[model samples]
Target chain A: MPTAQGGTLYRGREGMWSWVAHRVTGFAIFFFLLVHVTDTALVRVSPEAYNAVIGTYQTPLMGLGEAGLVAAIVFHAFNGIRIILVDFLAKGPRYQRVMLWIVLGLFVVTMAGFLPRHLMNVFGGQ
Target chain B: MTNATHGTPAVAERVGTLDAPRSPYVRKKTTRGNYELYSWVFMRASGVVLVVLVFGHLFVNLMVGDGVEAIDFAFVGGKWTNPFWQVWDLLMLWLAMIHGTNGLRTIINDYAERDVTRGVLKGLLYLAFTIVVVLGTLVIFTFEPCPAGADPELLASFCTA
Candidate 1:
């Protein structure tokens, strides 16, 4: 009775929403992964090309980009972990809110810890 | 069969189906749930973030300066030698892994009907996730672009004497 529409979960309004996200992120990650693997293959492709690619990313803007990437990964990873737990291990609906909050908390904690270091290196002394 | 005038209400009726709920197969019926809503929000949020992350990566690596040709062990080695690249790489690794895994989780849930089957597949997913995340995080935080001693050919120029 605690859920959106009483205690029954499947009947709730959010099932489709979750389904959509899973699909979108799934493909998004796949595309990125495919490109990533190919690009990293540059290490084997030719050292010159690899070096070139590396040099470009050394920019401060790119550093900001990477920070966003870290945030994405954290959200996806932690949420995925939550889904897995819900589907298999816990199988308890009562704990979902708690899990969500925990995921959010961890994400904040990680960013707080990493961002300062990143900024310091980017803007601080040589 | 459930008749409007007679005996038992159909299974459909119980779950609010237009027809009477008759299926003995119907287990517990839930009137509603919120899990799906969160997922919807997550997709949009992740999508926006992914757009930035993915494009940022592409722009920097493919569009900037000397571009694709400049990437190499020494180039990469030099970059990773810096703390910034290490963090950048770390973020990319973590995001892709998590996003992909979550996406797959949805696929599994939607397709798998049997609880036991779902459990097994999800178990495999979790196992793989753990291995990848652990190995990846370790590699990023502890990456040694240039080791202490290695063949001159294999080592970056900076690594060699």
Candidate 2:
């Protein structure tokens, strides 16, 4: 009876964390897409309607949420590539830990590059 | 139903024989060649492309010029007017929809206990995915920034200006 939950909770490895993050981020993005499509479809209605809906997303609170969304997307996309490589390449699983570190490094670098400007846009008084 | 061995004697009999044959169902692996392999490959490929398409979309919409505030009806219209942006958006729409749908299908198959339930849920998911993708593609390609003979008041300012 070798079950996935047989082990203790906090004793998981990088692979476990990556799997968890992938599922979480995948669900997050899917839900966001639902709302995004609905709102964007408002464009077919009228300009004022579309703009008004999008205007609500410009709030400071939504700004933070947007940043979180970006982080989720960045991690998910990077980890996804790693998973893909691990599936296709024979040597991929061997260096998966190293790949995870690389993914994290890239995530941090890309976020650092984008987040500051995004934060400024959100909080900067137009 | 008469096979219900009730009471402590039944429990005692089952205790040391845990390794005995369990359910009547025989688990056999079906050989579905290459479909799953190709699907796995597609997930990675589409995912890689989606990263670029999604990030580029975000960068252009949220980072360029006035940032989030710059997004408006005319803003979208302005983008869709260009063939490059139209193609970009169309690809993003199709790829993301298909990718996300497949991911959800996987989730449903993993958790759904009954075959009927899985089938129903996946059918509904595919239906919604098809509608959204089709409508989205149509809108992207056929969108009229300003419809002819439309009321000027309801239209984007650019239309009248």
Candidate lDDT (C-alpha), each: 0.61, 0.84
TM-score, model 1, chain B versus true chain B: 0.66
lDDT of 2 at A91: 99
**Against the true structure, whose lDDT is highest?**
2
Question: Candidate 1's residue-wise lDDT over B1-161, tens digit each?
Answer: 64756865676566785445574565566677777778666655665565566556645653454443345576566777788777776776766666666767877887788999999988987776776667656655554566554335644677775
Write candidate 2's Cα lDDT for A1-126 as tens digits: 123766754447998888878988997897788678778887787777887899988889988999999999999999998998887799999999999999999999999988989889889877
- iRMSD, per candidate, in listed order: 10.2, 2.8
Least well predicted 10-residue stretch by lDDT in candidate 1 chain A: A11-20
The second chain of candidate 2 has a TM-score of 0.74
Measured against the true structure, the TM-scores of the candidates, in listed sequence, are 0.46, 0.82
Q: Indicate the residue-level lDDT of B134 in model 1.
A: 70
The residue ranges of model 1 lying beyond 4 angstroms of the native Cα positions read A1-126, B1-36, B65-69, B153-157
- Per-candidate interface DockQ score: 0.11, 0.45
Q: How accurate is candidate 1 locally (lDDT)?
A: 0.61
Top-DockQ candidate index? 2
